[model samples]
Every structure is written in structure tokens, then in C-alpha cells.
Target: MSMQDTLDTASRKLLERAAPGRVDFENLVVVPLFAVVAALILGALTMLATSVEPATIGRSYLALLQGSVGSLAAISETLTAAAPLILAGLGLALGFRAGLFNIGAEGQILMGGMAAVICGFSFSHLPFAVLMPLCVISGGAAGAFYASIAGWLRAATGAHEVITTIMLNMISYRLVDYMLRLPWVQRPGRADPISQSVPPNAELPALLQWLDPNLRLHAGIFLTLLAVVVVYWLLFRTKLGFEFRASGASPEAARYAGMRASLIIVLAMATAGMLAGLAGANQVLGVLGRASPGFSAGIGFDAIAVALLGRSHPVGVLFAGLLFGALEAGGRQMQVDAGVSIDLIGIIQALIIVFIAAPLLVRALFPWGFRRPDSGDGRS
Candidate 1:
């Protein structure tokens, strides 16, 4: 071949290899952020429709900020909220990366919480050294086992995870309803569905010791951050991460390369479930001090939103969890201080997800509403 031809061929190979990753990264960053920005706009419009005063949004938001961080107690509560969200969001992101949607996190949380409570209450005379690890493992195992069913179905039969996970979620609610009230699981002589509190030594320590005792923030937030770093490392810096992404994007291509697609699906769900279980364990051992119905507070579902908002990246999920935690902590204040319906929070969340997933719809509609589609509303 001619020297010029050889040089051109080499340059083209390098260019192809270099360009896609950079362009892909840009898409990853912008799409999710744009979704969030659009959601806020839609949320603001919703508030205006409700006839809320202009300053009310500002006042409520400030109050929320004060509650979330201005004081020790608020900060504690904010961290507590973020703890479960981080774990749950990580779980969802993992599943997404493996082309599975483990929507059954709520159920997994239930089982994990139940497992932790059982370990905490049943075990006697154990030192804190053993007790903590025991609780963590048992909880994660419970969630892993719960999620495995959906994974098994997907592996065995081409079952769509979306359907299986949702079905399992329903089944989990019923199972929890039955188990929390069991003679062994329930609080003695009480009709309430709460379980006995975790042992004091078994509880996680609050990391911000400088904060006043009035604060409720525990060590769980640090752990959640740790999980984020680990997930990022796993997803981007490791061979397993590569396999997970490849399997997710194209199963056939993965099979062509001799990757074990089914095994990856099972292992991926197991990993995701383990994180979710840890969230359940955190609620019991750190924040709630016991198992309670609705302890997760739909954080599992919210994690999906967080994963989407964060573009399923670990760093994105952490920030997304914190943002949602802040919104949740502030939302009550928004309602009480501004008389805005708490329902508005739900509306805002839905709008954010909708707008983020479909920004083109907003851009196009607004313009016609801006240029082409505004055809006199089909009127004369």
C-alpha cells in the first residue's frame, strides 16, 4: 500500500476508537440533567396553576433547607432519608446496567428489614463486633433471595423483568403483611404491626459527633457514599462492569463474544438485591430501630426516578438521592408554610420524570404553542 493510504487508514482507526466514547459521555451527562431542568419548569407552572403566591415556593424551599441542614436535627433527618435512597438507587442502577428492572425493591426491603429484625431480636449475648456484621449479611441475603426469583424467571424463560418484578412487589406486600404480624416477628401483645427494636449496641453510630445530640443523623450516609464509589468503580473500572454494560445494550452481541448472559442476569440481580437489602437493614438498625410497615416509604420506586435522573451513574444516583431527600424533607414545610398541597410534590416528581424522559415533546409543544404545530389549534 502507498504511504499516504497507510497513514490515512491508521488515523481513521484511531479516530473511530476515540470519538464514540467522548460523544457517548456527553449524551450521558446532558440528557438526564435536561430532564431535571424541564421537570422544575413544569413543577413551577403547576404551582402557579394552583394559585400559590410567587414567594410561597421560595419560602417553602428555604424552610425545607433550614429543616434539612440549618439545624442538627434537620441534617440528621435528611441523611436518614438519603441512606435508604442511596442503597435503593444503587440497586436499580445495577439492574439497569444489566438490562433488568428490579422494581421489586420494596419487597426486598421488607424482607431485608424483617431479616435484620429477626437477627437483632433473636440473637442474645452477642458482642457488637459480631452483631453488626451478622445483621448486615442476613439482611442482604434476604433481599438477594427475594430478587433471585425474578432473575431466575428471566434466565429460564425470557420473562421480562418489568412484569416479574412488579408482580413480586405485590406478593412481597402480602408476605410482609402476614410476617410482621407473625407470633415470632410481631411485638408481644400488641396489635400494631411493628417489630421489636434493634439492640442498642447493634445500632450504627452517628458519624458527625460534633453535631448536637438532638440530631438524628447516623453513620448510614457515609456508608451510602461508600457504596456509590464502589459502584462507580465496579461499573467503569472493572471487567465485570464491561460485561454488564455489554449484556444490557445487546444480548446477541454479548452471546457472540461467549459471555454468559443468563448468569450475568442472575448475578446482577443478586448484587442489586444485596444493596437494597442493606437499605432495609439501615432503616431498621440505624434510623427506625425496628421493623415497621412502610419503613421504605416507596423509596424503592423513587430510586428508579433517582437512577433515571442520575443517568444510572453511581455519582448521579448519590446526588439524585440527596436532591430527592431534600425535596422530601422540604415538601412538608412547603405544605405547612405555603398551604400548598403535599400532592404537588407528587405532581412535580411525575412531571420531572415525564419531561426528562421526553424533552423533545416539551420543546416541540412549547414552540408550536412556539412555530410549526400551532396550526390555529385546528380552528378556523
Candidate 2:
């Protein structure tokens, strides 16, 4: 054979060897894993820089694991922490798929919780079957209405959702504060701003109370799971979902294809708001039993990270929520057992985001794992 023919044969062999390195499920899984690992290593280094001992770092991580899932009770706590996160993350993920940056979930959640609380207290005499569904629906509706405002502005006035949603969030904080102080909403004879507690009949039943009354895990977990299934089906199998994805991927192209760009935007934002509302409802009816100032506790904000970490996929969001929940639950343990600051968890999370967002860093750190397949001409 001629020299050119030999080179071509060699190129084919090289390409074959590199083919397995192309992006796929294995690469997807490994990339995130590496990101997490890198973040953890950086965290350890940070701890050492702060004069923390290596043994303390080890103990801190062990305590984190123990607090998150060391036993059945710990596992339950992790799940409880994850419940609202999963719901809110799903909402954010849906909005992301539709090309909307819905930063107003925090506001929508507050409105939903307020609506649910009102419904729960106003109809205290209703039967459980009647009241529970009503409360949930009311919360969702309130959230939808709140979110629709941003959507409307985006469609009708060409306002950006990011700006509108942020403004709306600030408005919601004051709104909820004012609402909580109202005589009818506030607990009778109470000086502090707090809403009346949800009636027993309206409260969501604990899912694993039989195992332990201390376990806070509630039926909201089921709700979150059901939402995952519904979202997955809607995004992959339905016509509206197609419109949402299409419009998100390219508004100009979708408009050219005869899709109603405005309508899709409105519907997507409304749906996302409804889901966020349910998360607020879950927190009030299932956990807190009442509303107060800052009741959301930043779950809406954390949900953005969860959605990003999950790649805006429903199933991915579920697992990402769980991971974040573990971090939250474990942070307390790390603080107690190892005398490490719980803020370390936040640092680790931020690092993970940074690493994930910059895949080239990860690729550079582990070149073999991400090496592109060679072309026939030996080009990457």
C-alpha cells in the first residue's frame, strides 16, 4: 500500500478509538460527577486554608452523610427538605425549556401560600375531601395569576421577564407582609405578623407517620413525583409542550411555523407559576401549617440552582433536588459534629455551579475523559 493509504488506515483506527469519548449518557454522568468531585476538593482546600484540620474535614463530611441518609429518620428529613425544592425546581425547569427566566417564583409562592391559607381558614368547617383540593387549587390559581402579570407584560409591552419578575418579587415581599398583618388573616390577639394556622382537616397527611411521628415527610412527596411524571409527559409527548420547546428554541422560527408566540409565552409562564404555587402550598399545608414573613425561606431562589444542575429535565431536577436537600440537611450535622461552618455547604454548591458552567475547565482537568473523536484527517 502507498503512504497515503497507510495514513488513512491509521486515521480510521484513531477515530474509532476516540469515538467512545463523544458526548453521551456516560459522558453526561461523568461530567457532573467530576464537577462535584472538583468542588469537594476545592472545599477541602478552602477549609485547610482556614486552619481547619484534615481530620475535622473528614469528620465534617462523614457527619454530612450521616445527617442526610445515615438512618431511616435522617433519610426522611432529607426527603422532607427535598419536597418543596423538587416542586419549585420542576416549575423553573419548565419555564427554562420555554425560554423564560421566571425569577418571580418567590413572589408567586408567597401569593399561593397566602391564597391557600385564606382558603384553609375560611372553609374550616368543610370536609377534608372538599377542603384539601380547594386549598391546593386556590394556591395554584393565585400563583398563575401572579405569574401571568409578567407574561402579559412580556407579550403586550415587550418587557423582559427578568426585570418584571424581579420587580414582582420585591412587591410580593411587602404584599405578604401586609396581608399577614390583616385582622382576618393574622392570628387573633397576636402582636406579631402571622397567619392563622391551617385546620387539621386541610393539612396534608404525613406519609410515614407510622414509622415515626417525628418524621416530617408528607404526601407532598407524592405530589412532587406525580408532577415529575406529568411534566415529563407534557414536555415529550404533548402538542403544547412542542410549542413551548419550539418557541423557546427559536421564537422567530416558531412564529414563522404559525405558532402563537404570545400565547405560548403566557401559557408557559402560567404553568410555571402554578407549579411554584403548589410548592408554597405544600410548605404551608404540609409543613409550616401557617404563613409568616419570609415563609418561603429562599426555596424559590435555591430552585434556580437545582434546575440548572438538573439541566432543566424533570427527572434530572428530582435527583438534583434530593442532592441539594442532602446538602441542607447535612449542613446542620457538619456544624454540630465537626464544628465547621454550615456556610461551607453553600461554598461547595457555588463551586459546583462554577465548574459545571465551565465545562472546559473540567475537560482540561480530565482530558482523557473528554477527548473529542478524531476526524479521518486526524483533526479533533
Candidate 3:
């Protein structure tokens, strides 16, 4: 064929190739949103199937909104829940960026809270000036160390992080339970597993106490924002960040490019663990003010949904966390107001993941409502 004719064929092929990736991208973005909408619709259907009216779900949904964000006190409670979610989800999201799935946020959180409690109760003489930072740092460090074990295993052996991290989560629960049962940690003569209240100095400053004691929003929200910024910087700016991302994208390619893949893996896990631990610490400092049995209430698991729903973007994760927090905090009112099943939230979460994971299905269904990505390479 003539060179000109060959070029024409190549260009046509390139255009065809480009169409799919572009369609896929649009599909990805639109599918998840549609999935959420579909999930809610499914939930309504479920309500009807269970002998509850579809209006029961919507009625409770509205009440849940009112209880979570309606008044000043409600808004504060929402923020309070959002704070820890922001921290924990960011941690999990970072791990995802580095191709590491550090699923031990629960344990990391427990250790962080336990460490914060230890610092708070022990440093009774320290002024709020010193005590708060001390609690924060100690909590983060405790979580980091706890996560390092899984990192070490991944680096040294071919062990998958999902397994080790999950195992560690269980261990952390038992360890924290044992520690809280100690006479020094537990309140004297208290039959409960709860620790003593953190010193008032260790408590985070509430943002709007003037509104009401029920307005439990605290300065930890600021800390969560700081964490998001810092994670964003580390992922895109510094050389170390580049190494972490490179390893995550392709470990072999990173090694070929002379990057330390193993080290990056360990650091990524450590960083993720630290964030999760800080979340736990926030629980203690901002809301709980003490560690107890089942303190996290499965926030770690909920954080996974937050990360996936946000596509692992820092800003996206923050908003997703808040949304989940709203759903969680509002669930109580949903149950109370409309007598709807609390399981509806989980139903929605599952549906969102399903749509996100298989976006093609969504695009097939929402033909006019979505889009896809593009790739321009051509060689047939």
C-alpha cells in the first residue's frame, strides 16, 4: 500500500480504539452514581416486599436527614461522625494507591485509642498544651507499629497483605480488650470493659458548644482536613510519593526503573496504618473520650465503602466519608421514624460496589445516561 493510504487506515483504527476507553471512563463515573440511585430504589422495593410501604423507606430517609443535618446539634453530630470517617477512609485509600490493601484499620484504631487513653491518663499533670499533641502522636505511632507487622510479612515473604492485615485486626481486638481490663486502665471496681474518661485536657475542643452539649463536633475535623492535605501532597509531590505510586501501579516496572518496591510497600502500609490509628485516636479524643469494647462499631469496614465510592481520590474520599457518616448517624432516626429495617443501608452499600466493580453492566443498562473512556493506540 502507499504510505498515504497506510496512514489513513492507521488514523481510522486509532479513532476506533480511542472510543472504548473514553466510554469506559464515563461509564465508571456514571455507573456508580446510578448504582447508588438504583440501590436506594432497590431498598424501597425491599421495604415493599417486606410488607412495609415504599413510603416507609423514604419517610425514614427524610427523618434520617433531619436527625443528622437538620438542626445545629444534628449538624454537629454529623461532623463528629464525619471526622473519624475522613481519617480512616483516607488511610484505606492511601493503601489502595500503593497497591496495598491494609484492612486492619479496626485494630489500628483500637491501638490508637488505647494509646491515647494511656497517654491521657498517665500524663495527668501535663497541661492541655502538651497533652493533646502527645495523645495524637502516641496514637498514630501505636497504629503505625501495629500495621508494620503485616508490611514486614509482605516484604519478606510473598504473603498477601489482605490475609495478614485481617489476622492482625483480630489480634488487635484481643490485645486492646486485655489491656483495657487491666486495673490501671479500667475504672476501679467497674465491672465494665470501658476505660476511665480521658483527662479533660486531652479532650478535643468542641467547635460549637454554645449551641448545645449535643453538638459534639470538635477540632478533630480540622485534623482530618490536615490529613487529607498531607496525603495528597505525599501521593503526588515528593520523590518518595512517586516511588509509592510507581510500585503500586506495577511492582516489576518500578523495580526495572530502580525504585525500591519492597520499601515502598512497607512505608505505604505504615502510612495507611498511621492514618487508621489516628482515626481511632480521634474517636477517643473527639467523641468517645475513652475506649471500650466494640468502640469502633465497624467503622473500619464502612471506610472501605467510602474509599471505593470515592474512587480512592483524597477529596472524593472525604466527601464519601461524610456521606456514609450521614447514612450511619441517620440510621437511628430511620429506624425510629419509619420503622424501616436498618439493613437497608448495607443493601445500598452492596449495590454501589456491585455497580462500581462492573461498570459495563451499568452502562449497558443506562445507555443514554452514561459514557465510557477512550484509548488511541492502533495496531491490528
Task: Name the candidate that leads on lDDT.
Answer: 2
lDDT of 1 at 332: 70
Question: What TM-score would you give candidate 3 relative to the actual structure?
Answer: 0.90
Candidate with the larger lDDT of 1 and 3: 3
Task: Return the number of clashes found in candidate 2.
Answer: 0
Q: Write the per-residue lDDT of candidate 1 for residues 221-340, one digit (tens) a residue.
A: 777888899989998899888899899999899989999988999888988888898889888888788887787779889889888777788987887788777777767767777777
Per-model C-alpha RMSD? 7.9, 4.6, 4.5
Cα displacement (angstroms), candidate 1, residue 99, comes to: 0.9
RMSD of 1: 7.9
- Give lDDT tens digits, candidate 3, residues 1-380: 99977876787566656666654456445666777777777777777788887666679779788877887766777778887888888888888988988788888888888898889988978999999989998999988888888998999996999999899989888887888899999977797788988988998888888767667889999999999999999988989888888888898999999987778888888888899889988999888888898787788887887787777778878877787777767776788788777887677667777777776777676767842222224422
Candidate 1, poorest ten consecutive residues by summed lDDT? 371-380
Residue lDDT tens for model 2, 217-297: 888889889989999999989999999999889999999999999999999999999988999998999999999999999
TM-scores of the models, in the order given: 0.86, 0.92, 0.90
Report clashes for each candidate as comma-separated counts: 4, 0, 12
Point to the candidate with the largest TM-score. 2
Off by over 4 Å in 2: 1-27, 375-380
